[model samples]
Target: MIALEKQLKDELKRFEAKEESIETIFIGGGTPSTVDPILYQKIFKLLKPYIKTNAEITTEANPNSATKAWLQGMYDLGVNRVSFGVQSFDQDKLKALNRAHSPKQAKIAVLTAKEIGFKNLSLDLIYNYQGDTKALLKSDIEQAFELPINHISAYELTIESGTKFASTPKVRQEDDELAFFVAKEITKHGFKHYEISNFGSYESEHNKGYWKLKDYIGVGAGAVGFLKDTRYYPSTDIDAYIKNPLKIKEESLTTDELLTERLFLGLRSNIGVDKNILNKAMKKRADFLVEKEKLFKDNNLYKNTNYFISDELVLYILG
Candidate 1:
């Protein structure tokens, strides 16, 4: 761990020297909580000079791995935000997903994080489990709200092509109705539906940058980063990352692609996109959606209805 920390610090120094600015830093993937707190402190110290003071420093942790002492250490070291992988509150569903923590641990972690003076807490919830009923999803959202967290991220259970779930015969996907129900319940609880996959308090500076397509630096195996018009990603192999941290695959966006991506990401936010950017076809459809009560024009910006289904809204606007 000590050696890895040194390598990471060295990489950050090199990157900072080359890059002009950084808006956010996200420490995620492969159990960052498992790393020693001292290492975290060192990494933060090295990053202090390069990162903006208000820059959102975020780290992901599994509930089982986030010990109380570690949480405090992280707080003292300037980690203002912590996101836990609390997939579900149902023990059976947790087991089915091969999660390491129990439902109780999820609650405990939230309380503990709050006790440790970390106010910016985010919980991850997965909906559309193979057997998830609307009742179960509602219970999950209710449980999430019970936590003292200000942010909640709910994702649909997508069957990726290479995962174990894909190879094995599994039950059918949870119907769209259940997924929409979960999203609606979350908004009713006062959390802002900032993005399609993320919900939080109105002050989510870190994630807001990502949603707005701002610059961020991600450091870790298989981590991807977007800075200005360029995108880069590290190799997925751990050994490869440690050996040659500078070996990153890079891509530059074309002018047309950049404008399209900006519109795509901007439409996901509550702030909505600039009305002037809507093409002729999109303008006609947007008008129809407003009439259907699926979307509304507010201050010249088209915004989705708070109770409207997210996927339907997206399809209507973009598809």
Candidate 2:
């Protein structure tokens, strides 16, 4: 908490100097609900000035730790949105993923947050893991609809470096067939598949900003921030960050690199990229995809018809 305060104070100074007005605040990647709500009170007070009038203040929480008191306390402190990390509602799937919370606990947490006046609620659901059957996926989707959440992030399980799953390697089941099925099922429930992994009636403005290449200040250890053509990375070491939060490594992107990012990120989400950004060759490919009914044109922007094949589409367009 003390370290976080120091970091926030430093970031606040930058905001003031740049006259930056923040539209969204997402407290995620770590279990924020585990921290006492009182810890955020001082931080919110300090940030109240720069926050926009209708800013979405979100906190990512675990189903087990986000109690009613915690939800109410944060809501009172200006947290209008809560994204719970409820990976699965099935007991076997929960155990396979090693989630601490049970199925019942996930239900209780969402209901609790909604009852406490959280207007915008979201939950994460992992699909396409090994042993994840169509029946199991359907059940998870149905259970999610029963909850009061307005958004759902249905992610495919990937075995990243140094994780326990990496050792087993058998836990991951990623394929185009399964991905399309899972995505179609979620959209059938009326949640727009806004992003490749995210589906929601209430899209995350913070996430949308990233796709649009908006600048944001990322705090804490191992956090990355983007500002125009440059990206900043603070020390990943927690102790080093607490000692000096200002020590950051910077990377400058070239015009080509930025263009590549704009294309890839834009196609992966509903945020379509401008036609003016593409060259003669890329524009031809975009037109081809449009003719094939794989891409849609909205005014001057080109968007992917299905997000499941976004990577392949990006490669073909940029090839």
Candidate 3:
């Protein structure tokens, strides 16, 4: 705890020096609920001054670990949002995913968070896993809506290298038809399909900050940050990061690379890309897509009609 606090304090020096205004803080990428919420008290205190008055502070938690006390502690510490890794409410699916919590635990966790005063809660659901049917996915979505959560992140299972599933890649149940069906089902319940993998009654500012390509400070081991066309990375080694949190490696992106990123990222989410950012060739392509009803023009921005084929559409426009 002491070492972590020291590292965070060291990282604060840069934000302090630049007089940067932080609008959001997401404590995620790992099981944060397992750690004592008191551990974050000092860190939040240190960051209080720089954070916006209405900052959307979020913490990711797991159903098994996020106890009522833990939820209350984080809420008291000004964490206005909590995203639970519920994945799915089906027991079979939970076992298949090797989730630590049960369906009952997930339900209880969300209810407890809501009762404890977290109005802006979100939960993630892993859909399109092996043997995931439309009925099973619908049941999961129905169970989530029964909870008090305002946002849902339903992601298709992907086999990443080094995971057990990677060895038996057939364990994945990703089909284009199933993925599209899941998106349509979620949106039918009034949640906006704001991003390809994200649906919400209310949009997530912290998540949107990423899709919008906003500059954010990333601290701690394995954290990455983006500023304009430059990307920043701290040491991935925990001991090295604790020893010198200020040591950062930088990567500068070329104009074409940055524009490509903007087009792709913007097209995949509700945040549409501005036509001004598109070149004559890109705009010409956009016009063709609009004529085909694959894209829509809203004022100056060109938005994808459906995020299901966002990748292929982006490639077509950019290529």
Per TM-score, the best of the predicted structures is 2
Task: Pick the winner on lDDT between candidates 1 and 3.
Answer: 3
Clashes of 2: 0
How far residue 281's Cα lies from its native spot in candidate 3, in Å, is 1.3
For every model in order, what is the number of clashing pairs? 0, 0, 0
| Model 3 stretches with alpha carbons more than 4 Å out | 1-20
Error of 2 at 300 (Å): 1.1
Clashing pairs in 1: none
The lDDT values for all models are 0.76, 0.88, 0.87
RMSD of 3: 1.7
Q: What lDDT score goes with residue 243 in model 2?
A: 90
Off by over 4 Å in 2: 13-20
Q: Candidate 2 has which clashing residue pairs, if any? A: none
lDDT of 2 by residue, 57-84 (tens): 8999999999999998899999999999
Q: What is the C-alpha RMSD of each candidate to the true structure, in Å?
A: 3.3, 1.5, 1.7
| Model 1 TM | 0.86
